[model samples]
Target: MSERKPVVLVTAADLAPEALALLGGYEIVYAGKTPSDDDIVSLCGQHDPAAIIVRYGKVGAAAMAAAPSLRVISKHGSGTDTIDKTAAAARGIAVRAAAGANAAAVAEHALALMLACAKSVPLLDARMRAGHWDKAVHKSLELHGRTVGLVGLGAIGLRFARMADAMGMNVLGFDPYAKELPSFVQRADLDTLWKQADVISLHCPLTEENRNLLDAKTLARCKRGVIVVNTARGGLIDEAALLEAVRGGQVRAAGLDSFAVEPMLAGHPFQKESGFILSPHIGGVTSDAYVNMGLAAARNVRGVIEAR
Candidate 1:
């Protein structure tokens, strides 16, 4: 008798055929959009998936306990925050991330946001559409000959630093785990980076140690009228403090791709601010990035399953 193929539960159904081809030996199970807590648990119980690829849903202890055969959990992107590591560890399930798979896409998005905020793109578009030729504000700032500080010198941060350096901008990186500094980038302490940088960009993960790292106190340490960019995690900054800083003119502008809460409510205060440019967390969702991340995730699952 032939052995049955192992089942793999995938939350992202739209994965390219190239990615799916990597897991041809496995029986695929697709989960619908915006899967809730119960939905994930139910799928685990019903499908008994040997592995799961989490795209944008949360995976907690309950869902992990539901699948008796689950041996691996792979993230479709760099961030593994949505997975409960503690629970997975206790259950002897291996967890993996697709590092650098979409670094270029994320770095490009971060740079785009920074440029949009600096040039007042959102505000100008609104004014132009309202039949006003308002070129008198002159709020746009130049990127050349200015210093940009990067928090967490991971793959994404390093990519952004290289791009900024090529544009005649001084790049400073702050990452304790970084073994060596790359060329065209200088090392700076957090205090010095925040104070000296005319532009500050976050490419770090959200952990207990640095949650809300850019609160009121840190914002105050920045140079007056500093531009802030966050393409990492939303919990890294305190939204209330950011709003106050923008209103007080302490922060010249902010470009945010993530928020403290997802699907940022329409009634949010930032909706009215021209100094803040926001995106719907589409940093790593490019066509090329999706395929890269999906293939990486497939490889992780295959590695774990084969090793066992």
Candidate 2:
């Protein structure tokens, strides 16, 4: 008789059939809705699965503590902010993410936001739909001669820089960890970049040091009427400060995909702010990207279970 394959628990949303097929022989346990820490603990205790896969939801310490048999944690996406990595590391659980799986999608979304802001696409479309043709008030700016500053030159940032360069925009980047800038991009310190850039885009992760990195003081350094794009984490920019800047005309336009608070509140100032475009954290949410990440997570789970 064949031995039973190790069990695996998936605590994310509905799985695509392709993602499911990657599990092959494993005994799969699906937690359809968002699971609380206590629920996760109970599930792990009952299943004693070889691994647990999670998406945007939090997996707390209690859940990690209860899963004694867990050998790996496969994150469905790149961000591991919701997971307690320290606890998992202490327990000798291998944590893996599909880091580059959605890079291109996110980069393309960032460029789209930048172009929309530069061309005043949202405002023009709204006016046209309202039967008021206000072309003069919504005059678009040319991106060809503008300077773009990238705050973090990671995989997504570099990809965005390439797109911006191809659009005839000059690219400058700032990242303390980066050793060298690509030939097309100029390297600048944060303050210099703020002063010189007509458009500024953020592409950094959320960490204690970078939380609220774009506060009032730093924002004050930016060139007046600067366009801002944030496809990265929301906490990096101060929401209240951004609102103030927009109201005061310090910021000409803003494009944001993520927010300090997920599913931004109904009456948020940005919703009413003119020339601002907001997406519901869809920067890396292309169908192809989703399948790529899901398959990567499934394969990670299989690897852990089959290790000799």
Candidate 3:
């Protein structure tokens, strides 16, 4: 008789077969989109999963408490905002994040957004396609020889800094907890970065202390016509203040991947608003990143499960 495989609950619809195969003897159950807290609690209680893999979904206190067999909570990507770490820790359950698994994909997306905003790609494309040639009035910001300020010095931030340096842009970074930095990247204080950088790219996590780090006052400190880019989290910027700054011409433009509210409505104000380039939080959803994140998540689950 063969030994029974342990049960693992996966909130996402699917993961790559290559990643699932790594678990060997784990019976993975796919539960697509738990819309409510009740559903989350029900699933954890019913499945009694040895491990829980979270992709884009959230796992909270109720879910953690309901599952006595839950040993680990593995995040498919880097951020841990959706998971209740305190609850997991209190129950002696391990919570692991797949940090750096999608660094390249996210860094590239931030760079892409910055370039598009600076060049006014969306605006120009729209105007030209509508049979209105406004080349005479169109102006684009030159990235070469510009100063770029990075808010965080993590894997994604470092990758973006290197890419900017290659394009002859000066890179300045500010991270209070950063230990070391590359020679190509100069260290700067928050205030200095605010006053000097022509482009400010945010790559920090959303914490209580740093929420709305880019508020009206901080935005006021920036040089006129400074471009803002955020691929990290939604709460980092005060959207209302950003819109006002853009309207007043204090800010040149903004590139946003995440929002304070997810799944922005069909007719959201930003859709018709000028000076803002937006995406549906797809900064780290590349095919390569999916594989890396899935495999890393699986490894975290298996490692924790095997420890006992």
Candidate 4:
């Protein structure tokens, strides 16, 4: 009888073919799209996977406990906030992330959001479709010579900063952990950045200390008509406060990719607000990023499991 190959579970319905080829020695099990926590737990219990390549669902203590043989949890993308790192550490399960794998893709998306907000692209498109051309009265904000403040200076943030700099915009950054930044990026405190910036983009992770970082108080401090862009996590901003700011014209526009809730439900208030631009969290959904992230995740999984 042939020995059974170790199981490798993927949280998504599919993976890039190249990535799958890299893990050809293992038995791959997919948990399907839009997997719930219970679905992950159930899959873990059934497969006893040696490693999990996280792509969709949250992996908590219960799911970790279900798979006694689990040795590693590799994130398919940069953010690992969905994984319970503390729990994984307690069980000696290593957690890894494919850092920078989707940097270009996400950074580009952030820039696109920023441009969309500044130009009111969606609103104008809708107007054009409705046979109304307000070219004489409509004015678009020019990005040149403007100051752009970025909350994070990681791979994605840095990439965005470069793009903004190329567009003749001054870049202010606010990441304490980042060091020896490029000459184009001037380090600034959050307060100073908020007060001076014409455009503010968030690329930081969501943490307890920074949750709702852009709440009513902070929003009040920003320059009126400042363009806001967030390609990072959603919990960083207070949705209600942002909505109010938009309604009152305290915020000129906001372009958001991620939401506090995944698959932002139908009839969400943002849907009706013309001041808001929304994307379905597809910042890193490009074909190139998919392969890059998958390969990175596969290697991380192999690095842990193959070593044992």
TM-scores, all models, native as reference: 0.97, 0.92, 0.96, 0.99
For residues 229-278, could you state the per-residue lDDT of candidate 2 as single tens digits? 99988999999999999889888899999899886889988898885899
Q: How does candidate 1 score on lDDT?
A: 0.92
Alpha carbon lDDT of each predicted model: 0.92, 0.86, 0.90, 0.96
Least accurate stretch of 10 residues (summed lDDT) in model 3? 32-41
Q: What tens digits encode model 3's per-residue C-alpha lDDT throughout 1-308?
A: 98667778888778878788898789888777534556667888888889988875678989988899999999988888888888888999999989999999999999999999899999899898999988788779899999999999999999999999998999999998888899989999999999999999999888989999999999999999999999999999998999999999999999999998886878877787779999999899999999999999999998898976
Q: What is residue 248's positional error in candidate 3, in angstroms? A: 1.2
The most accurate candidate by lDDT is 4
User: Residues 25-64, candidate 1, lDDT per residue (tens digit)?
Assistant: 9999888867776888899999989999999678889989
- For candidate 1, the C-alpha RMSD (Å) to the true structure equals 1.2
Cα error, candidate 4, residue 274 (Å): 0.2
Quote the positional error of residue 24 for candidate 2 in Å.
0.8
Model 4, span 1-308: residue lDDT tens: 99899899999999999999999999999999889999999999999999999999899999999999999999999999999999999999999999999999999999999999999899999999999999899999999999999999999999999999999999999998998999999999999999999999999988999999999999999999999999999999999999999999999999999999988999899999999999999999999999999999999999998895
RMSD of each: 1.2, 2.0, 1.4, 0.8
Best to worst by lDDT, what's the order? 4, 1, 3, 2
Superior by lDDT: candidate 1 or candidate 4: 4
